[model samples]
Target: VDQGHEVHVAYQTSGNIAVHDWDALRYAEFMLEFSEQHGDISEVEQKLYRKVIKFLRNKKSSDADLPEVRSIKGLIRRGEARAGARFTGLDDNHIHFLDMPFYETGRTRKKPLGEADIQVVADLMQKVKPHQVYAAGDLADPHGTHRVCLDAIFGAYKWLEKESWIKDCWLWLYRGAWHEWAIHEIEMAVPMSPQQLRRKRQAIFMHQSQKDRPPFPGSDNREFWQRAEDRNRDTANTYRALGLAEYEAMEAFVRWKG
Candidate 1:
């Protein structure tokens, strides 16, 4: 389970615009519960949203392109990531929200990899010097964040290697929540029990803002976790259909780029 060794996850983006308005609204409400260590600050956060709701109430007409502030959007996604990590048995301290510099601007449009992003990753890698480093390897990521993230990680790894800090680290690649490693290609498959499947779904729920809103703007209409779990379950089923033992769910991985 790699429990004793520190495992660090640097999810690169907030995945805010992946769902719809109604879903975003509801998710924002649920997220209010976990916004702080104290829990359930609906009075205060909802008060903030009320200002927006009130503002939207007056808009009989508005700029088609202009939308709500990105800070609100980023807020929901961060809460979702927090919830997802909790569902996966990830300790809050071990999970990091790099929320990479390039993703700070809400839109998918991004600038090239810069020192800001490289330094954040480099600092984390050096700080953790983890026994294992796992990252999203969805070369097919609808957005190029995965590609850019991989580039930054590889760049950091190269720096670490030269610094003599990461030669002993085990590297692993995880497909985005969108995709999974092919049956024949998986190097490591973490099987999930029925309970874990539910937990994964729960984690996906943490990203509620993406569930029904402009969420991650994916190819499918299904919520992110729905798509993720179905794909995960299906991957496991595919394995079983191909004559492997059945499992409730499976998050598969492959070898590192190096």
Candidate 2:
């Protein structure tokens, strides 16, 4: 609306909490511990049900002391439930959330990408007829979900092309938390002013469940906000090094040929 353009976001996954194997295990463990203490397995479900509520009430639990569970499937389900609640709570009047399947698999293995997943995306593309589409570029993400998501988008685009319903859309790939596009590989670098940077940080802050200490911070100990700021600033610096105008922050993207 601000730029006289429609903005729509499609999340392949609801960002079901910690998708890494280790993180999943940690979450499972925590739930198991809660079950054990309450002397009933049902309590585990109850606890997760209240997680978003507790967070909203400013009584979120610290991640450091959570126990680790061995059940991956159980954890995946719990994560999806938690993610749904979190997303619903954070819903804004301007943004619409599409109902996509939550393939609740983590680092252990890849969820078999299927036509259904591709079709969902294809339908969205046909409906939106967007001039641009962005897919995750972190093909080597240790957790694997990013790569899966990218493949799904590719599949959707291919399907649309086959049906002759494809629009003249430009596809862009963006890396996730694990990595950023190399300076030489960047095709588009968007500069962010100080106020824009602050606004971006505030938008990120809305995902309160992911703040403080996320379950899987990876090798980088910094919080998500810190990591994002550093990456954006680094991209800006890299652009400056190449004799571009200095910017407070920058987000780089690579144009995808496919």
Candidate 3:
């Protein structure tokens, strides 16, 4: 928003577990508490505990009345509201938000990429008529949401093309948080100074729910901010290694072929 460019963010999933309240360590503690009280659990209570544990472990439970899902949604809403507040002083007219209906964790995965999903994005593209579109680069995302999001964006672009609505809009794919783009795959590299990096980190911190310990850290135990900084710095280092001008940090993106 500070760059005087119109920015539209479409969150494909709620990212429920991306908050500080639902970390793996806390889940493990809950499991231990359940185990200690297992003997006193009635048949109905046992089933409830099992369901909770399964959800915590990133597994889908048969029971639909799980409180965890609701809690996740609440966390997501608050985080989004906080994010919006951070940009209140900026040019709100240049910022837009589009949230798609999708699950946060892998437990309640949504349906496969479909026409409706594609159409929604295609309509947005047609309306915006943007010069560029940045889609998610599904890199090492275990839950497959990123891949599905990419597919939806691709489908949307294809739909727009068939309708002759896609003009000269270019698509850029970015990967971060979970993984970074490979050195060979980076087409456009954006250099960031120390102040820029710090500002970026501050923006990330607005999602207070995702600050200290996110629910799904995957195999990487580092916090999301740390992971982001490390990935960006590494990309900058790779660029320098290739004889590019040294930068304090860099964000790499790969242009989508299709």
Candidate 4:
């Protein structure tokens, strides 16, 4: 966006399943409190909260979340995504939630990638006609959401490869917490100054829901921002070791042929 490029962020999943029950319950409780404080607690709102609370109380570890619970969690994630986008200087209109069907199972185990999911991604890419597309290259994510989303993008590209806009479009992949791009695989190394790195950390902090005690902290146990900073600094160190200029941090990306 700073480069005068029109940038849009499309979140392909609601990420409802990753929301911990405790977080959902607290949010629900807050809503109940908010409605009461406003002196407009509708009977329907009260009833809905009652139902959600009851369902959660009896919910087993293996049981799927109630649809109402799932919706609340999804909204929570959407709110966080929008907040993160805004923190990065994006307007609300430029933020999109694709909510791909394959990821709406309300369970950790998602459905296989389907044609509908591909069409949703394809439609967005075609509509945006973006010159560059950046996607997560973390196929080793234990949750498997990253892999599923990457697959959808690949599938979408197959549908749009013949389109004229695609000829100008370039796809870039960035590694996630699981790993960083190898030095040989990195085609672009965006060096970040100290202030820029701090700004990046602040931007990441916008996702409050994922802070402190995220539902799935994975094996590293560090916060998302910590992991990001460590990975970036390590990438920069690697570059310096290779006799390149030292940077506070770096973001590495690989241009995807497909």
Candidate 5:
């Protein structure tokens, strides 16, 4: 975006399942309290919050969140995403939430990838006609959302392969914090300065709901930002060991050819 190229961030799912029930309940309670004190919130909104609070309070740890509660959680994630994007200098119009049908199950186990989900991604590709598409290539994610989302993008890419813009569009695969591309497999390495890394951390900090103890902390107890920073610095160290110029941090990506 800084280079005058258009950029858009698309989230394939609502990410509602990742939000903890306790977090949702706390947010609901806060909203209800705010509504009571300010009297600015609509009656409908207040009633919905009340229902969500009540349902979440009684919800079992094994039970899925109520639809309303799930929606609230989804909203929280969406707001965080938008804030992060804005912090990175993107307009609201450029940030998209596909909320693919397969991921709307409101459970940790999502539905099988279907045509509707692929079409949602395809529609965005058609609309943007982007020159570059970055997809999550992290198949090792414990939650499996990354693999499903990547499959959706692959489906969309195949569906649009005959289009005129397809020839110009390049797909790039990025691994998550859990894994990094092998040194030889990495097609590109973008170096980052200390200042740039600090800014990256700040951008990630926009997701307040994910701060401290994230619902899915995985095996690593460190926060998401810490994981990211460590991963980048480790990549840079690997490059340095290979006799390359040293950098404070580096982001690695592998270009996908289909």
Candidate 6:
């Protein structure tokens, strides 16, 4: 910001225990609510109930508050993002980690895009008066996080725009864990040399647990590194396959359209 570039990172959720306690609590809460209010208990509800019970049994030996778990996950994600940004040249202060509220529930279902989330983001954008805002927009993300997160970012940007704070800033959306922008489609391709790749990996390492056990919604288990490396190499290789010069790894981004 001091040097004229202002950037921000908006995470969609407290992803740390997103899968464990968050989902588990959601399972428990839903079962309790459904069993009390509704007459027909669908298989989905019953299934979730059973899962919640299992989680409780598991938690019997541990201490895990919903917010605490979410916070831990948030910190891991925040640290990794900061490290990645540092490796890529964005400063630590440039990043604003908004640990959005609706996600704090130990329950499974998160709140809709509320004023609280949008206001905080909008205020930041307004204060910075940034020329650009980069966000994750993986609406097709299987975990539903991509969708929820994008909703919040879009909501915030739109709110800022309505308040006339958006005239100076352009919002850019990057796909989340599942995908990256194709080379031909990329408006910006931040290439990583071997040294940079090492740095990027170190940055990714800051994510700690996410590097190993990302909050996969279901049983398909693969580390974030495996996914990211495969995606990065495949992207570079694809470019090579298409006759472009190959690089060790690359971070690609597409300019988002409203």
RMSD of each: 5.2, 8.1, 7.8, 1.2, 1.4, 10.8
Candidate 5, residue 242: CA error in Å? 1.0
**lDDT of residue 12 for candidate 5:** 91
CA displacement after TM-score superposition, residue 115 of candidate 4 (Å): 0.9
TM agreement with the true structure for every prediction? 0.76, 0.69, 0.73, 0.96, 0.96, 0.68
lDDT per residue as tens, model 4, 1-258 = 777878899999998987888888888888888888998988998999988987887789989898999999999999988988888889999999999999988887889999999999999998889999999998878788999999999999999988998988989999866689889999999999999888888877877778887877778888889889999999999999999999999999999896
**Comparing 5 and 6 by TM-score, which wins?**
5
Candidate 6 lDDT score at position 101: 76
- Show the lowest summed lDDT stretch of 10 residues, model 2: 62-71
Residue 216 lDDT in candidate 5 = 77
Q: Please, what is the whole-model Cα lDDT of each candidate in the order they appear?
A: 0.69, 0.64, 0.68, 0.90, 0.90, 0.64
RMSD of 6: 10.8
Q: Please identify model 6 stretches exceeding 4 Å from their true place.
A: 1-12, 19-92, 162-165, 182-185, 217-220
Candidate 2, residues 217-239: lDDT per residue as tens digits?
A: 66777887887898899899988
* Ten contiguous residues with the weakest lDDT in model 5: 173-182
Candidate 3 lDDT tens digits, 1-258: 566766665555556544432443364356557766676556775565556556656644353424554554454655554575454434444344444445432354566667766776777778878888887795578677788778888888877776554657889988778788878788998999998898878877777666666656678888778989999999999889988899999988899878
By lDDT: ranked, best first: 5, 4, 1, 3, 2, 6
* lDDT of candidate model 3 versus the reference: 0.68
Q: Which should have the higher TM-score, number 3 or number 5?
A: 5
